[model samples]
Target: MPRVTFIEPNGTEHPVEIANGYSVMEGALNNSIRGIDGDCGGNCACGTCHVYVAAEWRERTGRQSEMEHDMLEFAEGVREDSRLCCQIEMSDTLDGLVVHIADSQH
Candidate 1:
């Protein structure tokens, strides 16, 4: 398992241990972390799981796919670091991954 830290807009942090092969969105939802509304159930079709990957962990998270990029275009507060949590799969290499919940999903 890898630990992921999800920071809320209000500066609250919810860190949880996520199993390998699970998406970050699933980790948040399982832990009851707020602000990540994965409406499409971890499908890249929805951008509701939007988050900002911490700069230090961005490289490990890797770049989004073409479909993911297109979906993110509809997300609020799009940024260089913006990514749909559903697209980020957990792995041992990303043990200390940190992501900030966006202010809005739509």
Candidate 2:
């Protein structure tokens, strides 16, 4: 399993192990990590799972898709590193990934 660290707006960190092929959002929801509502059930339709991919891991996480990019327009505190966790699949390369849950997600 790979691990992902979700940092909340209040600076709390929840590190959870996730199975490969699962989305980052699933890892958070399954582990009860706060701040990631995942309102769309891991689908890219909702922006509730918005997070900021750490700068160092951006390339590995890849850029947001067109749908994801468009959907993020509705999210709060959008930024260059902003991405929907639902769109980022967990994998060996993504192990130890770190993301900051958007303040609005809290």
Candidate 3:
């Protein structure tokens, strides 16, 4: 299993232990984590699952899809670290990834 930690804007830490192969959004949803609305249910058609990857983990997470990059352009708080949780697939490489949910989604 992998773990996805959401560092809320208010500085709260919400850690969710996720099973292999599930997206970070699935992890958040299953754990009842707040701040990740996942409005489009991981379809990559919505920006509601937008989050900022921790600077240290960005490289390991790899590149974002064109769709994600384009959708992020419309996100309220897009940043260099912005990523759609639905597009972030879980794997051993992302076992301990930490993502910060933008304040706008809170």
Candidate 4:
């Protein structure tokens, strides 16, 4: 399992351990972390799971896919680090991943 920290819009942090093969969105939803509304059930169809990857962990998370990029266009506060958390799958190398929930997701 890998540990991921989801930071809420108000700056609160909810850190939890997620299974290696699960997506970040799934972890957040399963742990009852606020601010991530995985409305599309991690299908990447909805942009409600938007989050900002911390700079230090961005490279480990990799680049967003074209489909993800398109969906993020509809999200508020989009930035270089903005990513649809549904696309971020957990792995052993990403043990300390940190993501900030977009203000609009609140």
Candidate 5:
């Protein structure tokens, strides 16, 4: 399982252990993690699952798809580290992943 951590705007944290192979968006939506809306499910069409990958985890998470990149341009509260949670593939390497929900989704 991959240990996922969701940080709230006020610094509250929600952590869950999810099976590998699912996207980070799925983990948050399924677990009711209270941040990610995943309005378009795991698809990259919606920017509702927007999140910020911890600065240090940026390289480990790799690059976003072209479509995801374009969609994120429409995401609210975007930052240099912003990424769509749906684009993140779950894996043991992401066990300690830290993400913050988009302000729009919250």
Candidate 6:
């Protein structure tokens, strides 16, 4: 399992242990972390799960796919680190991953 920390706009942090192969959106939803709507059920169809990957962990989280990039265009506060949580699958190497939930997701 890997640990992920989701930071809210107000500076609150919700950290949880997530199983390998699960999506970041799943980790947030399962832990009852606020801000990530995951409305499309981790299918990348919705941009409600938008998050900003911390600079240190961005490389580990990897780049977004073409479809994901297109979807993120509709997300609020889009940035270089912005990513759809549904598209970020958890893995051992991503332990201690930290992401900031977008203000719009609230």
**For every model shown, what is its TM-score relative to the native structure?**
0.95, 0.97, 0.94, 0.97, 0.94, 0.97
Give the per-residue lDDT of model 5 (tens digit) for 12-93.
8999887899998899888998778888878798898889887899888888879988999888888888999999989999
Model 1, 1-106: lDDT tens digits are 8999999888888899999999999999999888888999987998989999978888889999999999998887999999999999999999989899998842
Candidates' C-alpha lDDT: 0.91, 0.92, 0.87, 0.92, 0.87, 0.92
Angstrom error at residue 18, model 1: 0.3
Off by over 4 Å in 6: none
Candidate 4 residues lying further than 4 Å off, grouped into runs, are none
Q: Look at candidate 4 and tell me the lDDT of residue 21.
A: 87
Which of candidates 1 and 2 is the stronger one according to lDDT? 2
In candidate 4, list every pair of residues with a backbone clash. none
Q: How far is candidate 6 from the true structure (C-alpha RMSD, Å)?
A: 0.7
lDDT of 3 at 100: 88
Provide the lowest-lDDT 10-residue window in model 6: 53-62
Residue 76: error of model 3 in Å? 0.4
Candidate 2: list runs displaced more than 4 Å. Answer: none
Q: Candidate 1 overall Cα lDDT vs. reference?
A: 0.91
Select the stronger candidate by lDDT from 3 and 4. Answer: 4
| Regions of candidate 1 where Cα sits further than 4 Å from its true position | none
Cand. 2 Cα-lDDT? 0.92
Candidate 6 residue-wise lDDT at 71: 97
